[model samples]
Target: MATLSYNPSKLRNHKPQSHKPISSLSKPIKIPFSSSQFSTLYPSKFSKLRLNSVSESSVSLPTNQPPLTSASENNFNEDEEVDDDPTSEVSYLDSETDPENIIEWELDFCSRPILDIRGKKVWELVVCDGTLSLQFTKKDSIFQVANADNYNKGLQELGIKPVPSKRCLSLLLWLEERYETVYMRHPGFQVGAKPLLALDNPFPMDLPENLIGEKWAFVQLPFSAVQEEVSSLEERFAFGASLDLDLLGIEIDDKTLIPGIAVASSRAKPLAAWMNGLEVCSLEADLAKASLVLSVGISTRYVYATYKKSVATTQEAEAWEEAKKTCGGLHFLAIQENLDSDDCVGFWLLLDLPPPPV
Candidate 1:
């Protein structure tokens, strides 16, 4: 996670305003985690596993750690989403002839449904784009398996920090497609051996007590107002989330009111500093849990607020859903003084996007 600091003295006062209701808005929908008839896909652990391969002899995960499981967290820069056009949800490379022109890639380096010359399982590298329109494949026997230590070391070698972002929807969907059309056709394929992978997010953790602000409130501000304030802030640990709003058929404008949580604390600086280290993604109103879940780093959720502090009603859920669509799924976390203060200590602009498809 990257950090930015700005003087709070330069902030502008925003008057309290009623959030405009979005009429005829679509109802809230959960991220499609289950096949319509096959129940949930991969289990919890498999959702975060990358399909890399290593020699059986080189596998050395700690005794307590799961073998060959590590979320390859990427430090997705804010610029990946077009900064100039807030309405533009995706950014693409300029080359049409370069081949593999998509900015992000989905990969699967794992055992196939076939055997090699030595009667060993065949391994291959499968690549595809989000839409599944493009495909590339390579047959290989060995590659570096991804694990926590290997991921951290790779980032360290590149002189960069790890900031996990969204899950790889392309690879996930590809897995499901293969399971349905390809893998199941093999005579030796066993359902028990190759379990279905799921997109179940990890349980939310408790926030550090000290990081809780003195006061916080659910607020709504105009899109222009929120964007302007974030821009005016001198210091910010920011991430502009990439969204596929076109897929969702959501639209927005300057007057669109975005929903967010505003935290005011005497220890605002320290609070912002602590959050800066976490890859804060989006805030969700979990109706089933009746909790406000803060999604950060790859698949890590935190209990931002419980029902006791902030009730989760259908109306609230619908409001959040509407706001998310209208604003291209952009939600914010504003760390500042009391609700009335004009100055912002730290600001974060975030968006929640659905898992990619292939």
Candidate 2:
């Protein structure tokens, strides 16, 4: 079958803030020699796609780890009016709940398309291609957004693909385990700014009956992957997410649920970049496990090695001695300017790691 071409006139242009324009797939896709192995519409530069076929078979996951699935709750969609103020009896955050055996996290996410325009039915051929798209309404914007669609097939052609919204939480974990890169997606996420899941980031295993959007958690992820919550303007270069449940691929029942860390961040770059410009953060710790300190956050959790005594000093030799002694596992200490909130080149705490056990 002949591949469909993209429409040069309908493409949108975008200014990608911190991401690179993808020219092709990161890796070459192995096309199945057997035609029945896969079903896909070969879309070219033309902005047209049609389903070639539909086959029913259980999708074999790429990895052994499967996506999370939760048993449906009766009230998942039910809405009941409650007292707005927490001082009332309906307050969940105020009620008694176990503080331990819980995980909490707060993270900041940003998402914006380089180019955008709405798409509609063209001669009744318009159909949602099981994926999203960013329609370009102008000539220049199409160049900015997806001019490559004229010849390329799929988002990889335009350097765009729908990132799964739910799996980002899990993917963040995977990135930590796989790549050494510390930062998340490119900076473009900040362009169209809004706060979606600050409160929703924390989980409530042993939580109050009336929990509000306060940043609360037993353990928050230090750094983890997440899908940016956004408005309903779905597009090709659009955002992705994980299906809501235990996004971390953890077991969640009445007794066990894992939560992630999330924080509301300011759109403006300033004294602080994340969590709405709140620079100084406090974290809880386990006094028993003093040697290994864990930082809990919304997306991922991290551990820091600690010594028997507090080690803060201006003397270069003393600082080196302390770091060397503490880091039995590391071969060398790469110490930047000692901890400071304004330190542009070092670790900035979204939630400060709790003091090591005495």
Candidate 3:
């Protein structure tokens, strides 16, 4: 219950004046979250701690000792009444973090020192030798409810089918990750939670886990807000023994796979590993739009039936006859467009990481 600044009085009177940030919002439903919340810069923000001090030194995702609902959770809900859309019936765990009863926790999560002290919700997953922490920032909307049910249906539809863990991770990201802070359980990289903006020197990343904060605290997040949080993230993928050595932004912890229901496709898909030869479907005739990082993530099952692009389509061969003739005209070589078909559309690309060493 400590903080860099404990201004209970300021928090009580604070009311946001500008509506610009909420401009992109369509239908304009008002979701009154706390005044001083954190980042919305990246659709999803993630950082891990790699603890060297724990008894069993290991590479794990952010973790919390089991049963995460904290007891001080209940009274916050009773202190204030939150207004929302009448049509929105999403329910969340009944817990609150009212300013009148706020206890300031340190701003630092990992190596980063955050000033905001808002409530966050998280899901804990157990992986190989570590624990995975999926933290989120919540938002309110009917769109979130639809997104949640869609993700739920996706998991169930693929009941027995084996999907890659990476795909599953992507699906969750595409659903929601509204503006908020995110941290891992075991602190995979070990260093404290450093703000994504604090990268000035080469990462001396090897450090201790400093993400300790209130654990097992329950907060009632409207279902819509919860879904918004899930969608705003960018799922990360890392495999191979050398994943840790790269210093590239990819540190690790996650997975899930999905399949194309309409067509058979093992057709090669673009991958994060393809950084050396990063290719986009169309050239950016407009630099601002094409060059800009459009947010992308894997949702459990996104049914893009109308826009399916299979790289494995042999039908393309018939169309590439002219390029083939030119290669033959040179007498030494034959021409052909890409014979391999792996649609790159489904790939959820992460931009922050340094590409793997050439």
- For lDDT, the strongest prediction is 1
What tens-digit string does per-residue lDDT give for candidate 1 at 212-294? 77655556666567656766554443323233333223445555566677667777788778877676778887767666788
Q: Estimate candidate 1's RMSD in Å.
A: 13.5
Per-residue C-alpha lDDT of model 3 across residues 1-358, encoded as one tens digit per residue: 0001112233212111111110111121222333122112212212221111212222222255233332243232333443322111112221332333422111111221212122122222211110112222222222334655554576579562222222122213312121122222222222343433224223112211221111110011222221222232233232101111122122211110100011112222222233212221110011212111111121122111121123321222212222212211100000001111111112222222221110
Instruction: List model 2 lDDT by residue over 186-206, tens digit each.
Output: 221124432232323342132
TM-score of each: 0.52, 0.17, 0.18
Worst 10 residues of 2 by lDDT: 86-95
lDDT value, candidate 2, whole model: 0.20
Regions of model 2 farther than 4 Å from truth: 1-54, 57-284, 294-303, 307-336, 339-344, 348-358
In TM-score terms, candidate 1 sits at 0.52
Task: Give me the runs in candidate 3 sitting further than 4 Å from their true place.
Answer: 1-67, 70-75, 78-197, 200-342, 351-358
What C-alpha lDDT do the candidate models reach, one value each?
0.50, 0.20, 0.21
**Cα RMSD, model 3:** 25.1
